[model samples]
Target: MTDPSPTNFAAPWEAQVFALVVSLREAGLFTWSEWADRLGRQIRPADGPERTADYGAWLTTLEAILAERGVAGPESVAARTEAFLRAAEATPHGQPIRLENDPLYRP
Candidate 1:
């Protein structure tokens, strides 16, 4: 198989989210086929791909699956997103970004 382009992700967080999704799947949370179908639907939604971050659509799909599977709820995801953003904003630049211990992140 051909290697993916080094610039496939628009940002570092996108790559991290992609890795998280793969790790979840590898941990038996879902099958490869399930991920393929869900991600395909997200990539080609009724409104078509949004003119935004490359893997933003993929992240949405992963969240939806996680919510449906009871791994996390919509509110939890939103809360964590907000919490992470807040943490990032508070952190000084040039330091490694870290995920905060958000009460919303159950896992």
Candidate 2:
């Protein structure tokens, strides 16, 4: 299997989520179907205001899934969330840098 270190992931959130998923899978807390069902239920909105996707809602869903699987406790989830937010802040916005001077590219 590939290394599970955070540095192996291109994105911090991906690493965090991957860790949670792996932990859950190893623990055998729930089958894949049950995990999907729980996540789907969390993503869905109850009757009231217009339903929409939001960052908080997405994080909540992830947290709920992790909790259901017993992969992460509240403190761990909070720490991961903080790290995710920090990574988001550090990441660049807009188009990626173009390496036009590289020999691999001929334009």
Task: Tell me which residue pairs clash in candidate 2.
Answer: none
Residue 80 lDDT, candidate 1, scale 0-100: 74
Judged by whole-model lDDT over C-alpha atoms, candidate 1 comes out at 0.77
TM-score top scorer: 1
Give a tens-digit lDDT track for model 2, residues 47-105.
Answer: 65543443444457667766665768788767655655555555566633343323343
User: Relative to the true structure, how large is the alpha-carbon lDDT of every model?
Assistant: 0.77, 0.59
What is the C-alpha lDDT profile of model 1 across 23-106, one tens digit per residue? 998999988898878877777668755344357777888889989989999998887779888767766788765664333344
Best by lDDT: 1
Residue 59: error of model 2 in Å? 4.5
